[model samples]
Target chain A: MIPNTKTDPVIDVRDLKKVYHIGEIEVPALRGVNIQVQRGEVVAIMGPSGSGKSTLMNMIGCLDSPSDGVYILDGLQVSDLRDDELAEVRNKKIGFVFQKYNLLPRVSALENVELPMHYSDENSHMQQRATDALKAVGLEDRMRHKPNELSGGQQQRVAIARAIVNEPAIILADEPTGNLDSQAGKEIIDLLLGLNRERGTTLIIVTHDPDVSAAAQRVIHLRDGLIVGEGESR
Target chain B: MKLLQVLREAIRSINSNRTRSFLTILGIIIGVAAVIALMAAGQGAQASITGQIQSIGTNLIYVMPGNQLTTATNRRPLTLADSRALANKLRAPHIRNVAPVITDNNDVSYGKESLQTTVYGVEPGFEIVQNLSLSDGAFFTRAEIDSRASVVVLGPALADHIIGKHEGIIGMVVRINDYPFRVIGVTTSKGGSQFNNPDTFAYIPLTSMQARVKQDLSSGRVNYILLQAEDEESVKLAIDEAALVLRENHRLNLRQPDDFSITNQEDFLSIASSITGVLTIFLAGIAGISLLVGGIGIMNIMLVSVTERTSEIGLRKALGARKLDIMLQFLSESAMLSLIGGILGILIGWGLASLIGFVAAQSGTDLIPVVGWDAILLATLFSTAVGLFFGWYPASRAANLQPVEALRYE
Candidate 1:
């Protein structure tokens, strides 16, 4: 993997803003928010409620477009791309983990992991890749179990297995430990750190827990849809 | 994504809600079944009427008084003289036999048994012209007809009603409208058909009926004339000649419509077919309305499914599924639902039509329920179209969902 520094961040954003229209009123969710994360870097985004962290996560994950921004994902200009083109970029470049471990409730865990590969053109070895990803998440034995059949932590593990199945450039997680107990939360954070160190994957995590943020190599704070502070973590 | 994968996903989703899916497609099942059953019944009726016409001999024609489309009231009725005139070889050489038919509804009795039956006063050649055969004694001869003899030919059913046995009934005497006549013949049984059950009637010579029974003999009027054409090819010639001879006999002018109508075997067949065709269209029209309602039901249920699975849609989108993929998934689900329902409906309709045919057969009517492959194919096409048409809106709704908005939905 190529080592990327601040000058060569995998994700680059500048003056990104998102305004939602509710009839005549415009609610600005993200106001000129900008961030950059290097390859193999574990960064955490922390913010109070309604601070537009979720909005920022959505923009970075390519799930929504900004009203105005210059966003580049791994050197490709993505902020102006169409919905289908953005989906392609997300499929190949970004993986997402939601707070609720949003795995499809009806399918088996292995199939859940294989979900991302279905959208990929290089899907010939999807089954083998999904099995390997599940094994990496320590869910090899629970491959056939559905999401509802697994524990909350196990389900989140399955979600992580899905996120990494395509070997995406960056993992964007939203409150990954919010629904877990202290023990499961610690295990999840350790897993995320291990992925960053061993695979050189870029991690941009949005979290509320200070302990989770303290484990990251860097922390960026947001308030009122703007970045307020940034510092290297111990 | 591959089409097979989308279909697989759709099948999995539909299988997850088996009961609701089945209930949702019930309207389609019933609608398709109605269409099949109505079309089958109409085809069966047409076949049955055609068979009846063929059984009556394809070469026969009926010259009845008055227009077939209008009232016969006040029109000059047909007469035995007109029938005899049409039988002349030089005038209507295509005619094989011309039998004058005088019909009266009467009560005929034996010792203590009596029956309300019809009495047919026809010439001696009626048995041949009507394609009837005797089971017991011979039909009246021309001499018997000239003598105005009180001899009668009994239909099998009428003889059974009067005498209780077919073996010794020919010589038995039965009363017709309180007048006594000796039964000389008993007709062979024509199976229990829906139209024209001649087995309930007794036939006598036209002279015997006119002289002994009718009070209007001076009018020289007979109800109608039954003409047996030489062959099916000669029917047109026979009809034209009979019309000409009758018009001359009745002294009608060229500008006026004839007082009588000539109906042939083919005419009856065509009329019967057209009526059933119209009926089939009408029944299918009604069934089409129900199918439209069924389509609406599918749309409503699919919309509900889209809303209920909003988060799932969002999740799929997040996983990089395109709008086309999402749309195809829902479309396949709806199409599969309607197609399964259509197959079940075809079976139900076949069974119902067979039941109708069974009942009709038991009553001695030839109704063969026809389920043509064309009907099945049309039904399949129609049901699939319904699925696609009804599937579009909800599928588009699911496909157009914004991942952010959908993920936030409760």
Candidate 2:
């Protein structure tokens, strides 16, 4: 595990809450949760069904706004930002990876990696940067291959290339290897851990797999919309 | 996002569903083509009719007896005296010449070929005033009118039909109303359809017509008078001068309306154009309704597209695309579809209009469909506007989707 060398935390949350209203019922997905993680940390959030791990990941990724709380990502207050501002934050700061490898179906791997930059302020050298990102993910030979033409492991690697293309501060991965076979899943895990080690990219992965958690520098446990426990791994 | 990138993305999406996209734009294609084709037809009809009228003569005016605007039955008949008065240069300097004409349909026969056709009783000035030129022989002289002699001129078509040829037909006696009148001349062909053909008439001396055929010499009345102005610029002035002279000859004061109406060539042209303008607008309006229906079809397909691509929208949002980006992407896709359909519609419409012109020409009608630039521009702009307008709702729906729900959607 990398030592906590940074003085300030990259992500700091206090009393985060999210409630969904379906007609007349108020269902609380996240209630009064708090979390803090340092830069260059690889953290895994683990929970069974209805444990609010998905909601927490959504909040951290800036894909949604919390009902009530304080969220400071990289020292910028994000809890009260509007929808468009959240989109900007997501574009420039947070990258996402999904278990299904949410790369656009018909687009080539290089173009998929270029998507975040298309939405970013970086207007120059996009092709070169996307090509470099694909190379980093060991997908240089399959730059022109579409998601369907790739294997599960290759698709996940392409998704990782897309995630890191903009050099975002955090890579928020949800069930990144849930759809892959064991061997492919191990390769994907190694690729991600290798990124964490080589580039020091902050990774916050939400998964139920113990093997993925064992590979993280720290594992966070959640139950019933609240954090139950956390411990340093290694 | 760059516009080119958005357009490229739109093209890819549309190309994926080629059949659906084509079907969706079919309505726009038909609507735009109909608008162009029908407008072209209307313009062609207007052009052909005006061409025919102008072919009759330049700077010509017609003086007919009656209050054409009112339902009065006891209208006075125009007299040869009115024609003579309008012909006086001192009284109406703008009037160049006057021809008094009286027409009656009569059975005309040369040899054994007999056909019922209009016989025009006219003075020598009729040849110049009506722009008639002889194909063979010569026109009757003023002495024929003074002596009330039996002399006749046949139009080219009339000569061809009754005597089978214009050559060697001069001096051939043709019976008009069973009265023999020697054919003096045959006028040049002025190509027209059978229904309104000017090249199918027989001309004779006015006095001969009144004395022999109608037996109305005592009435001293002519059907109408044809007046030619010195030039096109003086046509209106000639009409005004003729009206003043006719009022004086008829003894009509300021309190009474003139018994005769003088109509200039510009009046005919304006009336014909206005009628055609209204017809064109009416046709275009109906075609616009179909374009509106086409817009509705685009909206329907876009709505379905948004629904089908729900997960894509979610994925794009997660990748940090703003709502406006998503909206513009869908909007451009629809606009592109309509613009393409509009361009194709123009080509097809031109083809259809040309076909109409070809068919009309084959049947001896001088019609050439005119596809104006204004029609094409209007169709292009209107179709694109329709796409954007109708696309607004569905695009907004796609933009407003929440990433969480969309990503979860199956």
Candidate 3:
């Protein structure tokens, strides 16, 4: 267990191991991974399929738990956290986007973006924050369109807008542009970079694309559940 | 604004699956409508019967034997002697009026339209004792009955068939039991009675009917005894006195129990009301079971909806929807479905009830179904309750779903 200290990283990882037990067989998803990220950093974790990158992203995003690990995220030990507390942590401190552009299809883009604010304790003004988030993603003009009515790129932008509407300390995207074309994907990466540079929002993208890795300042490459490369990009 | 948005979302969700939503509500509609229609029918029947019983008069009592007591058959047929014995024993304080009745089924020749009727033989006081109306001509007097008069009074239906809707001829002849009897008067129509047709009957004086139409009264038997009291308040006393006199004359121990069932208006009304009430509720209860099935229909559809919108649920949860928000949204949707269905059901049920009332009036029953506001309110409240009951589980399941897993659902 990592002792509670003043110098805890925003995400502190040490010997994180994730095991999946299906019936009698145990599949090791993440084997003894250790990493740390300070505040306000754009870090891309890159690896091919089945390299445990998605599993690591799940642990980092507080979406699941590791079988054997001590994951201290934003100074709170998150690995053994209960469901509600995990949800609270996810609600208050982490924002998520996915490649499929998972905005609710029935609601307008604005409602989808403002929904996360309903979970937060911040009662100042949800509307202004929602508008600001949309403005930040540069899709404020099409706020009234439902996901089905919006193009793939616009939908992805709306999802990113929803992820940041709560003003979480970190933004996590797993294949955020995986469903979009090159132009749409580049626009999404540029939007993430712009948010990182302007608001100093810590950005973590999980992808296997070279373009996605190149857009980040640091690329952590993994192979077969082990980190094969970690260095500043050229 | 928040409420409007929630409602809009709910409406859109329902609109997205119009076929399924409408199909689910069909069950609720039928259940509620059936409940209303069945209850209305029971009420209408009970009301019509009660009206008939009241219209005849409360003071009259029919003492028919052989049905209530099989053992009392050999004792004696209810006889004119018994009626006279009671009349003689009955004083001013005991009873006001008493009349012995002699009735038999006979064919009446009304022009060419000869119909079978149960003819009644009544005394002079029997007209007032039973509240039989006199429309055209007066009833038979004591002299006419005592002199073994051949005069008879035709009921409205018999009169219509005989006189060809012409003005009544007070002194006319109609044959009864192959004997010609003078028509002294015509009684007003008492309408159709469910038990027997009062309209097809012809009335004659008791003594005249005894000698000619029934010629066998020497065996000492009559059909019924009609009684009347001095006032409405003294009817109970008259009843008790009549019971005592009959029991004493029949030589029965009062402790043995009454062989003849004495029914008054109060007893009749109470029995009828209770039967109608219980029958209506039983019918309503069966309809309520169908409503529950309808509620289950809502639940099953909502569950399917949750599964269909797995990605949407995940997206909403990820967007910071608390468990309660999602729950309220779905609950509102389900409640809307049922409440709307309930309204339609009430309208249909009320229309059906009114249609029944119209048909009854056409048949001269004059009974209306009790489609009171209370019934409508109750149906609406119950349907909404069904909505809530069925909607709770699916709403909770949707609320409690994990956002990540939902989003990950393909």
Instruction: Considering the true interface contacts (CA pairs under 8 Å between chains A and B), give the fraction that model 3 also has.
Output: 0.30
Per-residue CA lDDT of candidate 2, range B252-308, in tens?
778777777888788888898899889889998998999999999999999999998
lDDT of 2 at A30: 92
What are the runs in model 1 whose C-alpha is more than 4 Å off? A4-9, B30-50, B65-98, B104-117, B146-148, B160-167, B175-180, B189-197, B214-222, B229-260, B273-297, B349-385
Cα lDDT of model 1 overall?
0.88
- Better candidate by TM-score, 1 or 2: 2
Better of 2 and 3 by DockQ: 2
User: How well does candidate 3 reproduce the true complex, by DockQ?
Assistant: 0.34
Error of 2 at B315 (Å): 1.1
Estimated TM-score for each candidate: 0.85, 0.92, 0.83
For all candidates in order, the CA lDDT equals: 0.88, 0.89, 0.80
With candidate 2 superimposed using the best TM-score fit, by how many Å does residue B6's alpha carbon deviate from the native?
Answer: 1.3
- By DockQ, the candidates rank as 2, 1, 3
Which lDDT tens digits does candidate 1 get at residues B1-410? 88888888888988999999899889999888888888888888878778877887899899998886765445787877888799899999999998889988888789999888789998888888888999899999999988989999888887777789777786788888778899898889887653557888889888878877775656678988899999989999999999999888878787667889998988888888898889888988898888889899999999999999999889889989889888998999999889888888888988988998999889877789888887788788898789999999999999999999999898
Query: Which segments of model 2 are wrong by more than 4 Å?
Result: A1-6, B69-77, B109-115, B156-167, B217-220, B248-256, B285-290
By lDDT, who's the top model here?
Answer: 2
Q: State in Å the error of residue B49, model 1.
A: 4.8
- The candidate that wins on TM-score is 2
